[model samples]
Target: MRKLTLLFSILLVSLVSAQTLQDSITFNPQQQLNAAQRILSGNYGKAVTVGAYGEVTYNQPEALNGELDIQRLVLLFGYKFNEKTQFVTEVEFEHVQEVFIEQAFVNYNVAPNVNLRGGLMLVPFGIINEFHEPTTFNGVERPSVDNVIVPTTWREIGFGVSGKLNNLSLGYQAYVFNGFQSTSFDGEGGVNGVLKGSNGLRSGRQKAIQSTIDSPTLSMKLDYYGISGLRLGLSGYFGDTQAEDDVEEIDGANIGISMIGLDARYAYQRFTARGQYVHGSLSGTEDYNNLTGKDLGSELQGWYLEAAYNLLPQEKTQRLFAFARYEQYDTHAGTDGALARNDAYNRNDLTTGLSYHLAPGVVLKGDYQFRDNAVSGGEVANRLNFGIGVWF
Candidate 1:
């Protein structure tokens, strides 16, 4: 009896120590070195780290059959070479069939506030493009503006520098990356263009799969969080699209692009709010449209605003938040050549949802979306969505 009691006491003490250690570690997502530094500072002397995040969703559109899908499953792998260098990668599976390399990068800390990174990296555009973990946002589906305008999950092969100023509570990133491919040769003496009026540059993403580069693009972002509960971001991208070697000399093979974005997020007690605006201007669209027989737009714009309130007490480990968002986007905000603006490309969405945080890295979400377009006599297809998300 005494031996068993002693063993129980030892186990209890060890468990208490582990719990204490875990409770003492705190992380700030707004910090530039949050991910890499967390691993190096924690991990209990381990050099290798593994993590994952995923989401499963069900959608039911009005007058349409419901569909259930494993929207995304991503596995994270990281290796800490030393105090100053680390490698991180995320492998993603979409819809249970398609596989993608979402992010693969090497970060080298050169100074206390500066780091250099390279490889396939997410573009630091709007909020969702860079901070897209499933549990990080409230809605079951991402804001439509992020999808249609900012083009979430947009990443490219690049090298750049990122750092934060502790005193100023500011972060910055700047990189030179391979731009989108506007037109590519099909190898059968035919040419195909990916840019269109409906989705702007979304379909032009090469995703680093044998990506070709005709011109290097400049992308940069600045974030400020000096205010207690507010964060602001400004981003910009400028470049010309790439074309296949065969089409490089063509009159309208590529287009020049300039995009800018602004976003803000705030949290005060149990209330939170966020907003974003993105605008893009395309040059040479008239010539490209005539040559490719496509209706590509000259200007694209989108914006969204959201607010949420937590319903649960702060002392509890779980939380429930009710949120509402409004989004507006226009892919054909302007047109060039003989092309006319398409009212159907001007869209808006109103979404209201509840996100239940069952634990720190797990959540259940439900939302209703009223979707519409500017086209005359167009029918609206509202949707109901439910989803489960997890991150670890």
Candidate 2:
């Protein structure tokens, strides 16, 4: 695989170089975009960018309890198809155990006013839903609400459009993908019972939970960036998730999710302020009776807010930044019937950290966090973490 990748890279470089030579012989500012595409050999220049991030988190369940562990590595790559089209990918490795491709998509610019993308793309549900980077956020970590309910970096198969009018940027996307499955509905109990510990619920099977060829999900997003360095967005999704020929006879799951987000930064004289908020709910039927019977749905919800400041200004070469964040979520909100009865359903986390720049595209960071589990008998969790991140 590595050899094949290297060969492809070399071929692409050769093509790009040839095109660049031709473009130099016939250069025109008015036709720069077209020239770039031609030089790229197709529509865009054969360009590639790569990035990676790694983190380790420690949390103590209580003052006396030992720390729990959380860690991950995230990598991203993009291929420019032109000014109008690109291919992007994101992969994640959890606990240094295994790697999974989180996102892989092709984006096409239909017009200056419209665009379309498909493949395994982010679900476009909430503000931080699509781009949840640890260093990018204000706090030591993302919000609890985002993790449990809105589910950041959530993706499915779909397509949509985005563009600019005047000073405002407008965008939207619709996709057909898998929806959430209920634990109680399929004898899985709840996310808390099934995913964290026992795996009784059929929902435990993330690999099995996918959109069938016959039925696909739909999701969309609307975003604006008219204000200098300020971004505002809202998104929603509705979908059906059901298994075929299952013993439970569960018909399908219905879900409605929504979120609003705001972000801004002023990089004058080496100072910056950035923040984002996202809230959403998950509702649908679960196989409770183990007989394909539907039950009252649960409300899963969460949100996060953060802020950051750069300690050393105008020293991009010697990077130094400080940030903090608070996040919370409840997986079993307002559910009537269940084996757990909302117990072990709530989580709150607070994090603060500092980062140092190792190079133009590299960084090292360390942080500490405090966690609370309202449902887990008020257990308190805390931990320290450090890691590295880079982009090229």
Candidate 3:
């Protein structure tokens, strides 16, 4: 199996490289969209670029939690079909065993300020959802708020448009796509509530290979960066998650989901700060819970704030930063049905860490976490973590 996988990977890389070389000659350094335009126009020199990233972690509780791991590895491919059209995709391996098509999309330059794209694409919800890239953020792991609220790494089979108002430093992305299936809403496999613990919305991702469209979802994002090193944005998502499936007296499960989020990032001198807030609700969840015999919440929320400063501000090749973050989230707020919301459902976490940069895209991190859960005795989950991450 391993040998076959290796052979397949080698063949895939060769195919992409050969195609890119035949279509384009150069690769201009810029954003994905701009690069797509140049590649499609046959103006770039490089046929393709290949890179990967990985993170390894060690924890205080070495027996069950602490171990070496390849959190993720990715192979990115970009190709130009013509002057106005291009294609890009990301094939990712998770935990070294699972493979997925993280992204696969085609782009068309419709105008100076607009581009249209379709296929499997990331959902732009918060800072980390679309631009995670590991090296882009601080700490060994992504923020907790992103996990339960905005839900990073969220993608779907969809069609969308994106463009920028360069003069105003404003950008926008909006899309319409197929939504979640009620079948992924079963009550087993450690899934809790009318939805799922892993995110009732995220678990149902059709992943682009095959998608169910009984329910359609709409998502939009508006971002601004008028000031140097300062960014602000707002995003929203709405959809009917249940897909109107045929289930006896389960009409109530055919519910609606609405979510809104706000995020900000700013940097000045050697100091930096970031924050994000998200809130959402599901309609008909109360009745839906009764019909499914699961405890699902109607209201969900998450938020986080972080600050960091470079200790070696004058160093050009290396940097040491001290950072702290606070996060809060509730996955079971306003749970419907007979099962009341567990106090432990609301969680607060504080993390303090030091990150040392050995070079651009290479970092080592150490952190200690303080945790507080509304449920009794939940504080025992605190631990210390150390990790290294790199990308090229």
Candidate 4:
């Protein structure tokens, strides 16, 4: 880890020095837009913009009946108040019934390379949490690590600064956000804590729905694209969970958390590769678990590597990609006092599939997964998945 840090520092310095020497070139804000920015960037005038994206999926477990559903449909609405300020929002419909305000934020361009943003926004944790448009990723479903460990689509009300350094090919984000909820109480005086061993901090996502903030969290992410055909990211999050007012003074009602993530993506000719690693440590878990009667782990870790090759020629409007990925994650990587680790929490998956892009904004996908766990004599179920994704 130290070596990796040193190498990143050296590369960053070299890029900065090179950029300093080329200060004469003009900077185009459009050229510097990242994936999220591109999605939010509307027409070049002061007007309202509308867009939508959605996915339909089918999944079949071995020896089980297949299920099909409209996984998600998101509508994007943005208004450019002026060149200097804009408001963007996304409304999501999950499973054709559940509704959510995925993001609703205002951005003010304070300078050519910096912007001040505020409102309910996505947490910049890893790749998928922010750039999760249906057409943006390969596979019928997202990586398991992203789903369980990093908790994709996690969001909270926050304020932050974000921008790009075009010359250095770097983009940066820093935010102060509301943290997760560790526990809550019911009207009937029942303990309803959200944190558990099965999904780590996933269930704690407050989603800004009349959420409480006894503690604030800090999140930051840096993206480097100085090297041709490659993109690298480093992310960090730190803070403590919140508890309902009723349990505000109770011991173990909240836990301190610190997490870090590293990810990279590379594309060269017909080949592409990507990987991510995430680790988190929890403080006061022992006491928290004892109080809530929950099985929360002290440590959580996960990682995955994927590679893909395009089978079609570059000139073709349509393309086909064959890909494979291997993933391993453990929500119970470490247990607290008197808590026994659950081997079922230690799991891995092997997935292979094909993605056919019929157009830039439309794709058909199919994949099979071999899922297993560390438990002896465990009955693991494999799955086959298919999906269609569209964006416009």
Write the number of the candidate with greater lDDT, choosing between 1 and 2. 1
What TM-score do all the candidates reach, one by one?
A: 0.91, 0.69, 0.85, 0.90
**Model-by-model lDDT, in order?**
0.84, 0.50, 0.70, 0.84
Tens digits of lDDT, candidate 3, 1-392: 99758946875776566533322111111221222232344336454544445677776742346666777876656666665677877778788888888878888889987999998888889888765665567777788788766666788888889988999888999998776654433435322233553354555556765665676799999988777777888999998873433442255555678999999888776787889998988787777666656556777888999998889955365777799999988877666656577677688889899988777667899988887878876554676888887754
- Model 4, runs deviating above 4 Å: 1-36
**Which tens-of-lDDT digit does each residue in 1-392 have in candidate 2?**
69547845764664445322222211111121211123223423446654445555554433555543446666555677568777866667777666667677677878766666667666666545554554344333555555555555465555555444644454455565565443333346422112221111223223323643324556666656555445555666564443333422433332333333433333334444444444433333243322234333245555566656668756344657677777766565445345353445566778888866655445677778777767645666577665555432
Q: Is candidate 2 or candidate 3 better by TM-score?
A: 3
Question: How does model 2 score by TM-score?
Answer: 0.69
In angstroms, how far off is 275's CA in candidate 3? 0.3
Winner by TM-score: 1
lDDT of 4 by residue, 56-134 (tens): 9999999999999999988666667778888877888899778899889999999998999999898988778886776
lDDT of 1 by residue, 299-388 (tens): 999999999988998667787999999999999998987899999999999999999988877899999999999989998899999999
For residue 212, give model 4's deviation from the true position in Å: 0.9
Candidate 1 Cα misplacement greater than 4 A, ranges = 1-44
